[model samples]
Target: YCEKFCVFVVSMDRSFLPETPVPSSLSRRIGGGHWDKPYNRGSLMLRAEISTVGDSQEVSSIHSGQSRLTTVGDRLMDSKCKCGAKEQLILCKSRLEHLVGDDRKRRRCAVNRGKLAAAGQAALRILSDDLLAAVTEAEAEMKACAARIIQEELVAGQLRESEIGIVERGCALGALRDKVASLRAIEKASQEKLRRHVDRREAERGSVLEQLHSRLAVCNELRATLTAIKSRLSLMRHRVRSRQDSLEVARSDMEVYRKVLDEVPAIMVDLANGERETLQRREELERRAMALSEEMKEIDTQIASVTNSRAQEVGGRKRCLEREGKELDQLAQRLDAMQEYVGDCQQRRMSGSSRL
Candidate 1:
């Protein structure tokens, strides 16, 4: 009686207990097998419910110790009890395959014939109630599981969205960084170009300034040269004025000389006439002198012959002839004096002509 009581109490407790989650091993086995298929979930739920019902009925039967209470519940439990885990799984599969078809046929036949005994009707109603309760529990479990899955999916979706946003922001930051770097490089290049241009312009400006300074110095030199030229030109102008004065004096002297020269031509003609007359007289005198020289030469030759002849005959007459010879020498001297007077006259005439 104690054993029966204990079994009855355990069965009652099991029936009244809140449904627990499936064991990890049993669920893993089911999940690892064909139960992994989504379409088998309903069958799995039905099998679980049927197994619970069978276990409860088996416990109750052990308490009652009666075979007469044996029904579908005992049959299911007996089939399960006779097998190991794999066989039990196969039996559960076969029962699940026939459950829907058999229930439908039995309900249809009972309704059509109206031949069901009260006990059978009552058992059917009880089974129907149990099936409905199991279905409701399974539906509730499915709804809770679906809600949990949806919540998990929502959390996973949020995490994925955050990750995607982070990735997109990182990509944007990288692009922005690259753009900034490019902009900096461009700025640097532009700055360098500007600096070079400025330096070039500065060099050009400096060169221009230097050129301007050199040109200014050149201009100063030119100004100094111009001043010196002006001074030299003034000096030259003064010298030209003096030269003009000298040229005017020379012109006046030349005019006086021209008048004197015009008057001197008549004087020159008169002198020429006098010179011609003097030349005739001098020629006549030269002829006379030449005749006298010939006569003196003949006299000298005759005296020489007389002296030779008288040398023997006239010694006393020779003294008298010497006195006569002295007289003749005095006459020759007189003729030479006359010749010198003519030569002096000719020289005076030449001097007078030259003066003219």
Candidate 2:
């Protein structure tokens, strides 16, 4: 019984027990129900033994008849009491009773409460931290997505602007090309017209050159004829001087004959015959002088007519030469204008080529 009781106490307080087993008498008392009544003397002694093993409430409730037993056991244990008594056993028993009261009903309740409280607090802290981190991460992701969307929109707008610029430049270049083609066509037409005008001018110049050559030849022939007429007129004036000198010599000789006839006169032979012969001689001499004067006047009139005709021919030739000169000047002006127009066209062509 004592060994059984010791084993039960050892099991209950294993954290405080030593390596040794309990006494055999205590083991037997623990196993038997004969120790069930607290007032029985054998049971009271058993309670005392149980109190030494820390079963305090059982010892306190035992019979008062066992007080001496308890006191003797206290002395044998040699322990001090709180009441200034040398009663180690009694003090140990009273301490065990106090510890085994209704307060010790559930032995592991307090420790379990502490562990559960700690676990709950740690779980609450972890959950709060995780929630805050999730909220922050979600906000950051939303901001990044918004920024990317804005960048894409900006790039799209720039692309649209570039496309518009390209289209406008293409349109402008096309218009310029059309204008250039029109100008080239107009220039080609003008060149054709200019060529025709030059050809016509050359034909007219050739005709005028031929006419001038013919007029020059006629003028030279007229000059030669006028020189021959002037030589003939000089010879005729020399012959008229010789004739005047011969007439004067004849008159002097006839006067001398008249003087000789006067000296032998006074005899009257035939008066009517002498007077008729003298009158016939005077009429004949007067007729010869009058014919010579009339011939000289006719010659002077012919010479004047020839001089007027020569002057008219010379004046006509001079007038024609002046007209020809004026025509040549006009032709020169036309040629100069054509040259200037050609130069302008060449310059325009060069400029157009540079632009291309």
Candidate 3:
């Protein structure tokens, strides 16, 4: 009977004891229990009764225990553990363990994901910075290339303008050179013509001088002949006067004889014949003087013609000389113009070369 009573006590103690603590590794399996039970066993409840005596010590102990239990129940409610059976507890400690493990794993995963996202963002930021730097460098290079091209183009344009100017100046110089050449040719021809004219004029002047000298000699000879003729004329006149005086004396003698010879007629006729012969000789001398005067007039006309011809020749030579001088002046001016043009061309060429 005692053993049986002890067994009953042990059984009751076992029912009141807390459930065994589940291992952390095995908590998930226990929380997910699939054990089968009958419908009536799930609904069954076991009850225990205790006897109380009035004024008993055990009763006081029991009342004190009951009060303590009630106080513990109130405290459990406040702590949010209102369920009475530890084995059938609403707040599953085994499930809580499993949930803590699950939460730790989730938190670790979230942390890893956040770290990965941060690393990716950092990598993207670095790539973007590098790209921006490369783009800026390329833009700067492009700008530099454009600036260099513009400078080259401006220089080329200036060179082209200089070349064009040089070409135009060259053309002008060429034209001037041609003009100078033509003028030189003209001047040369004019000089040759002038020389020929001078030569001819000099020859003509020499011929005129010779003719004048010859005419002068002829005039001197004529003058000498005229002087001799005048001397002979004077001598003839004196001889005629002496003969007249003799004739007068003879006539006076003859008159005395005629008175004596009034009886002789032959002597008187001979004296009359002699007087007629003397008169005829005087008339012939006057005729010779008139013929000499006509000859002198003809000589004067020939001298006047020679003088007029010499004057005309001299005037023609003077006009020719003036024309030649003018041609020489024109040639000099043309040469000067050509020289200036050449100088201009040289300056332009030098300027163009420097620019190039």
Candidate 4:
């Protein structure tokens, strides 16, 4: 009757026990749990609502432990007794193999699960013996003593688990504190690096901008120089055209002079009217033709000088164009490199922020 009443009371307690939130995968992975470590033992008791349908919440004691008080009570109401710790361990190993499908993971779970199964079996044994005592009254005194001894052991186990839990958590907390400190240091370093990069980028941009301005100025000067060269070339072309027209006029004059010379001989023979006046007119025409020929020679020399100057100006402009193209290409390459660098910095900033 006492055992049954105790079982009833434990069920009632479990019914009202609060549930704890599960941890996330990332935290669990980083937690670095050891199978023998206390925190990994799970909660003091697995209180399922299904097992204690009518039970409700009440206060629990710190010293007695849920394991000592409730192990038998909880298990008596269970559908079937799970096998002993060793068998459960085998079962856990099989589960690890079947579910994990990896040697390392299975090994990790096996280590943890093996300890868990042992604790569970120890718990189950207490419950099984309790039920056995309830059904059979033989050796009641011995069983009672055994029950008290088991309860004490269970309570001590629970206390050890609790203490280990606190210690492990303290260790974990310390680790986390150290990590936070380290992260802060890294963050400071990165921020400083980023600031330096920003300063460097600013200086580079300013220099590049100044260079661009200078290039623009040079380009403007070059344009003005080219315009001046064009004007000079146009003037030269006009002079050459005018000289060509003068040369044509001189040739026509020479042809007229030759015809006049031919007629002079003819006139002398015929003894025509006013022969002295005709000879005077012919000499004046010869002098005019000679003057035209000298003018033609001067025009040809001026044309040659103008053409040479034009060729020199064109060559100079070609050289300038080639130099300007090379400068522009260098600037373009620098611009591309700067753009790529800026992009990489932005990407790093994004990745760092996401990690935080």
Q: Report the lDDT of model 3 for residue 198.
A: 56
C-alpha lDDT of all candidate models, in order: 0.51, 0.47, 0.48, 0.49
Identify the runs in model 1 with alpha carbons over 4 angstroms from their true place: 1-146, 231-233, 236-356
| Candidate 1 residue pairs in clash (backbone atoms < 3 Å) | none
Per-residue lDDT of 68-150 in model 4, one digit per residue for the tens? 34543333333255434334333433443343244345456545655544554454455556545543643454475467557
lDDT of 1 by residue, 292-334 (tens): 5575566557656645654543444446456645754664565
In terms of lDDT, model 2 sits at 0.47
Most lDDT-accurate candidate: 1
Residue 167 in candidate 2, Cα distance off native in Å: 0.7
**C-alpha TM-score for every candidate:** 0.26, 0.30, 0.30, 0.24
* Candidate number that wins on TM-score, 2 or 3: 3
**Residue 47 CA error for candidate 2 (Å)?**
22
- Candidate 3 C-alpha lDDT tens digits along 44-157: 111111111211232233346554343432233335443443332222333333444555665565456445445544554555565466557556655765675576567557
Each model's Cα RMSD? 75.2, 46.9, 39.4, 44.8
Lowest lDDT 10-mer window, candidate 4?
25-34
